[model samples]
Target: MKCFEKLVRDFITSSLPASMNPLQFAYRHNRSTDDAIAHLLHTTLTHLDKGRDLSWSRHTNSLAKKARQCLYHLRRQRDFRLPSKVLQNFYTCTIESILTGNITAWFGNSTKQDRQALQRVVHSADQGQEDCEGPHPSQQ
Candidate 1:
């Protein structure tokens, strides 16, 4: 068995009630052989064979997914010729919230790749905003 799997098994066997079935527990795995991870409250915590470690890839990926979905809706509203103010409001209310939610907890610990991925989401939204600055279809 892998190191992480063994560690998880050991932890479960020790902490859980004997009467409770093991199948009820949910452990997050990326199929990695050396680490155990878990998802809690939109955050991901990881344990590695090297030592206790934190991995934010899962958390950042989920944030990117939610932000992209919000961006998609923002773009759709832009295509519909919604006013720039309304679009800005939508972004603030949706995408910004997704990107910033629990940011203080994970942003500092997140890897460079994960941080770059999130930046791309915001950059895409910025590009869309630049397009909005031009004469609107109705105005032109």
Candidate 2:
């Protein structure tokens, strides 16, 4: 904690008098390995098995919930006689965007369960999009 104390001391002297909020900081105990810290980057950092691993369970679950909500909206618009292209645009903007946001950062390391959960969202959206567009010309 010396480093943190030194930094706080320096900042207080150089800038306006500042105070630290005890609740805003997370400290990992020497004997604890299950502690996790979540940051604004939409991912959780965990120290497990003596190594640092990024857990995407929470992030994926959140994305799936949002994407499913978007899918509901897409289906509603389709029932309202919205154009196929407009529905496609909506899916792209809402559902797809949520699933793909920062994908490269966490997807590669995500567990299979997390990946499958996300895939289910995509699959449902795909089925909705297909229904929105009707049967393919070749299938007729």
Q: Which lDDT values do the candidates have, in the order given?
A: 0.77, 0.73
Cα error of candidate 1 at position 107, Å: 0.7
| TM-score of each predicted structure versus truth | 0.59, 0.59
Prediction 1 TM-score vs. true: 0.59
Q: List clashing residue pairs in candidate 2.
A: none
Off by over 4 Å in 1: 1-52, 135-140
lDDT tens readout by residue for model 1, 53-131:
6578999999999899888899998888899899899999999999999686679779999999999999999778768
Q: For model 2, what is the C-alpha lDDT against the true structure?
A: 0.73
Pick the lDDT winner: 1
Error of 2 at 135 (Å): 2.8
lDDT of 1 at 83: 90
- Across 1-140, the per-residue lDDT of candidate 2 in tens digits comes to 99998787666556632463433333312312222222323333333423755476898899899888888898899889898889889988888899999786678668999999999988887777677687767778
